[model samples]
Target: MRRNQRQAALVCVTNQYSCERLILAGKNLALSEGLELKVLCVQPPEYASGSYLAEIEYLFAVSRRAGAEMIVYYRDDPVRAAVTFIHANRIAHIVLGGVPDPAGSAF
Candidate 1:
């Protein structure tokens, strides 16, 4: 958290529209505050089959095109894994809306 160092902003998205909104807001915030932008999409364990893998790739490309580094991961318990990802990355701010917090955790 040094003055010269940049904080990271995490944008959690489930749908295309939300992802687009996050991209716009994330980029603007990053530009304004000099923070790094990261987009995270966590797929449920049940949806981790090959069929969904394609969507993951598509999202990855889309997020990158929107000007954020993207990370896609799978877990039976995404809440826990997302917490881990947030902590491990030392994210300073998180962007999300209308999405309920996972049952066992708060974000």
Candidate 2:
């Protein structure tokens, strides 16, 4: 794919240890669709210090190993930040973790 292509699979995550799965899911989806893979972490400014920093660094390394670049955004509203990133990056697909429901919902 060309470097200037806008379509990408965006994996959005919080400060959770289970984010590796999300990153891999995004990578697989991007591969299948011939799109770029991207990982995004949105956190508040309060969590910018201490252990959170270390966890972010680890996750960044994981993202790189998966052939994706991780982007970190410190914002008061995570949803807003994710939306901004989705638009700015021209994300075609989003990989997010949530509670599984027996009644499936449309994407």
Candidate 3:
């Protein structure tokens, strides 16, 4: 990718905690590619009752230290929200956690 492009490396987290690794990965990838780092979390509206506020704040701090901004989107369809965010932010790289399903389960 060109250095002058407005591209970003996005780290997608599923919850408010356990995101340090993702953030670090995004930071390293962004630094190597000359891109900006971004952190994203998508959750259902019901989970927005502030129950995980502290954890979210902590993740925000981690992201800040990693030179990335953490953004949270409350939506029923996480895939759609993430897609929109990617398009809006001109994301060039994405880092996320997942495990293979031997049975090919579908969400």
Candidate 4:
């Protein structure tokens, strides 16, 4: 990456609580020098009512204004989607809001 190139980070928010946490985390990441924050709101297959998309977009804009580029990914299973996105985009970091038990939790 060039000096002007920004490092990208994705934050996966799977729930209301997670979304709030992810926003705060994204803001912090945005403040870092040359880092871009992407807030991805993961909606389940049935619960995707399109209400959170705008919120996600708004957060992305805020991140951009904070000196980092902002983007939003609204999809089923935001975590998995974000992982795929990062791999495709060669993102450097993934900032998860909380610790999840892989064995107990199904993604």
**Top candidate when judged by lDDT against the true structure:** 3
Each model's lDDT: 0.73, 0.85, 0.87, 0.59
Model 4 Cα shift for residue 93 (angstroms):
1.9
lDDT of 1 by residue, 16-74 (tens): 54367666677777777778988888877666566566556766777787678888777
- Write the residue-wise lDDT of candidate 3 on 2-90 in tens digits: 44657899999866467788899889999999998999999899989987788888888899999998899889999999998887787
Q: How would you encode candidate 4's per-residue C-alpha lDDT over 28-87 as one tens digit per residue?
A: 765663456665555565555666666655655555554444444446666686667676
How close to the true structure is residue 80 of candidate 4, measured as C-alpha lDDT? 84
Sort the candidates on lDDT, descending order.
Answer: 3, 2, 1, 4
Clash pairs of candidate 1? none
**3 versus 4: better TM-score goes to:** 3
lDDT of 3 at 78: 94
List TM-scores for all candidates, in order.
0.73, 0.84, 0.84, 0.54
Report RMSD (Å) for each prediction in the order shown: 6.2, 3.9, 4.9, 6.0
Say which prediction, candidate 1 or candidate 4, comes out ahead on TM-score.
1
